[model samples]
Target: MSDKRTVLVVEDEEMLLSAVSMEFEDAGYDVLCAGTAEQAYDLLRARPRVDLLFTDIRLPGQLDGWDLAERARALQPDLPVIYVTGYSNEQPRQVAESVLVMKPYRMSAIIDVARRLGVG
Candidate 1:
């Protein structure tokens, strides 16, 4: 068993997902990538634990980031969540104890939040 903490990153945009995943990886976390909320849900179900969830507000399929966070919280009640979105005007229905970060955020900022959340 590795000591490295894990983070599940959900983003529909392939490039953004890749970039974010790489940043997390570089920051010494076990990075899991999902292109949609459904896929992220599946990963959450399959994995025993995930240290953090960094997701985009807008996503394809039946669930959005808010929906995914709700479902994930059901599975892991204390899971740390960070919601990222390009649309600042979108009214956020965020979960408790979670952070909402706007688009064009610095990777370091995200990593710092994860660390503060006790992830890495």
Candidate 2:
């Protein structure tokens, strides 16, 4: 077991995922990268502890970020979520202890949000 906080990041865009994962790693978190919601869910089930979920709203599979968060919350009720979307028209359905952030956001700002949500 590690003392570092863990964050599972889901993004279809390879560059974006890498950037976000790197940022979370720089923030002292155990970063898990997934390109789809299904992969994220699998990690959620396999991992005993996941401190945060940072995911893109529009994913490849049937389950989007919102569904992914809901499912994750079912497994880990207190999990914090951060949903990102580039599509201006797309809106997030509310989930407890979660925040929706527009695309092209600052990584530092995300880290701050994670900290506020009780994750290091």
lDDT (Cα, tens digit) per residue for candidate 2, span 8-106: 999999999999999999889999999999999999999898999999999998899989999999999999999899886855586977888887899
Cα RMSDs, all models: 0.8, 0.9
TM-score of each: 0.97, 0.96
Residue 17 displacement (Å), model 1: 0.7
**Which ranges of candidate 2 are over 4 A from the true structure?**
none
* lDDT measured at residue 13 in model 2 versus the true structure, 0 to 100: 96
Model 2 — which ten-residue stretch has the worst lDDT? 88-97
Model 1 score (lDDT): 0.93
